[model samples]
Target: MNNIVSMAWVKEHMGEPNVVIADCRFVLGKPDAGREAYEASHIPGAVYLDLEKDLSAPVDEHGGRHPLPDIFDLTVALSLAGIGNETKVVAYDDQGGAMASRLWWLLKYLGHEHVYVMDQGFAAWTSAGHPVTDEIAEPTPVKFLAIVEHTMLVEMDQVQELLGREGVTLIDSRETPRYRGEVEPIDRVAGHIPGAINRFWKDGLTVTGSWKVADEQAERFADLDKNRELIVYCGSGVTATPNVIALQEAGFTNVKLYAGSWSDWISYSENPVATGDEENA
Candidate 1:
């Protein structure tokens, strides 16, 4: 199945016994704003998942701003949200699919293959006259046994080892300004990891904020060799999942996420940071 699904697909399958809808809206700074918005109104039967609370672990010195949650804990949370191993999940968010993609990636990493990000997100659903409700859903929790796909993840140490190595590509998913060390509003450090190329994750979407076609996504990464290893990261790990999906859509097989990302890279004082346009570096 494709990584993205349409609003029509979601509307059709929303209430099915094996179908689960997840509302994953979140803001970067305002942690509570997502839950508030979800309470105000959301897709009927959609269970809310906060980026910081449900999707990430508590921050520490090493694991970026939003670290990957513990495997067992994450599976339990998914089970509580009515997602089982066999459930077909469709996640939607108002933030241009970033939060939704995060959930999609997490599910895939946990060896769940039937998960997708709802295209164009919640606003598009509402604009298209889909039914929504403020009443929270009470889905029956089920057992979700996770079989982690260890190959989908790349640790900081692995990333450090692969820096400047042949047949490996590190993609920094931040915007050009942040990647160039011009302005970093989030992380302490401004520059990106040394030898990492910038591939602003938002570029995977069109000007109107919808995900581009597979060919278009392919064109965006045409400069890189598809056979080589591609490791993608953002400030933390929340935003990089979209690029991971995009790369997969573009037919890249050897792709992984540097979950700690730039925030964790700078945690070690000895790690090198690079600034300015270094696409070929």
Candidate 2:
């Protein structure tokens, strides 16, 4: 399956045992809001997975916010949702791919190549006049074999080592204000890593809220060699996923996501921070 799926495609494949539509809806402020909304209305046979409960484990000072969930737990959750190694998973959320892309990335990390994100997310699904339901279908569980792709993830030390390095690029997926240190609403630090460049995650989306065309996405990183190592991060690692997807859609293969992101970088007082519109690296 392609990395992006449409509402029509999802509708056509709904309820198939080989397909799973995961409603990865989430609202950061109102943590339970996504689940409530999902309960109210969701795609038929769509299983709701919360960002807090299913996608992330308990965060600590060192792990930053939205730390990656335990591999065993994630495997169990996917298994309970009836997702297997062969399942073609379709994930979506209302807030672009802010929440949905995490699932997409997670599935890829677990060596599931048959995963896709519903382009434009649940809003596009509903806007297309597709069927939604309050009924929750519980499919029988199956074993999920987790083959971790360790190369796709990076820690703070590796990121630090790559700072200002010639062969790698660090892209910050936060908004312009946060990236420029103008305002920080979430983390204690208001700046970005010393060598990172700001690429707002929304830039990857079209005016209609769907992902940009392949050529448009490709143009974002046209100056860089596609094979060069690229690291993407945002405030808490969650928002950075859209950029990761954008990079993939752009045909870049050596992309890595900093799971801790800026929050983890700032957790240590000795770590450096840069503020301004200029290229810090």
Q: For residues 1-281, could you state the per-residue lDDT of candidate 2 as single tens digits? A: 45888777888899887999999999888998999999999999999999999999998878788999999999999999999999999999999888989999999999999999888877777778889999987978999999999999999999888877887988999999999999999998899998788889999998999788778999987877776799999998888998998888889989999998999999988899999875533
RMSD of each: 0.9, 1.1
lDDT of candidate 2?
0.90
* TM-scores of the models, in the order given: 0.98, 0.97
- In order, candidate lDDTs are 0.92, 0.90
Worst 10 contiguous positions by lDDT, candidate 1: 272-281
Per-residue error (Å), model 1, residue 197: 1.0
- Local lDDT at 261 for model 2: 92
Against the true structure, whose lDDT is highest? 1
List residue ranges in candidate 1 displaced over 4 A. Answer: none
**What residue runs in model 2 are displaced by over 4 Å at the alpha carbon?**
none
